[model samples]
Target: MYDWTQDKAVRVLTRLASEGLQTDQIVDDIISHVDDFRYEAQMPTFYFLSGLTGNKKVASKVASLLQR
Candidate 1:
């Protein structure tokens, strides 16, 4: 059987972004209401949406954009 919960979460986040929520807000919202996310894919989805602090290159890019 195919799982739909994870795909549902991704769609929710995508729709939220398309509706004009900023990236930081998206992460914050995801964290605050994490219970809405399916447990099976929570960790990976959280990290993918929230990002990698230890990734210097990606961090720098994000920071640079935020600075503008």
Candidate 2:
């Protein structure tokens, strides 16, 4: 179930990225639900997305998200 959830997240992120929408916002929203992520699976993508945004608010949010 955990691995499956991670895969869904990756798929959703990929679709959102390809759509060329506000991916950073989508990433932030997903990170806020970090409990649904696996530490080594879906999370690294969120961390990278957060870093890519270069926004302090997003980075800080994801940092705390990772702590959970």
Count of backbone collisions within predicted model 2: 0
Q: Write the per-residue lDDT of candidate 2 for residues 1-68, one digit (tens) a residue.
A: 34655656665674675466776676667656655566666555664454445456557766775597
TM-score of each predicted structure versus truth: 0.39, 0.46
Number of the top-ranking candidate, with TM-score as the measure: 2
Q: Going through the candidates in order, what is the number of backbone clashes in each?
A: 0, 0
Task: Name the best candidate (by lDDT).
Answer: 2
Root-mean-square deviation of candidate 1: 9.2
Q: List the global CA lDDT of all models.
A: 0.54, 0.61
Error of 2 at 41 (Å): 2.8
lDDT of 1 by residue, 1-68 (tens): 43567656765774565456664566556555555656656555544544334534435544553586
Q: What is the C-alpha RMSD of each candidate to the true structure, in Å?
A: 9.2, 3.8
Model 2 misplaced regions, further than 4 Å = 4-8, 11-20, 65-68
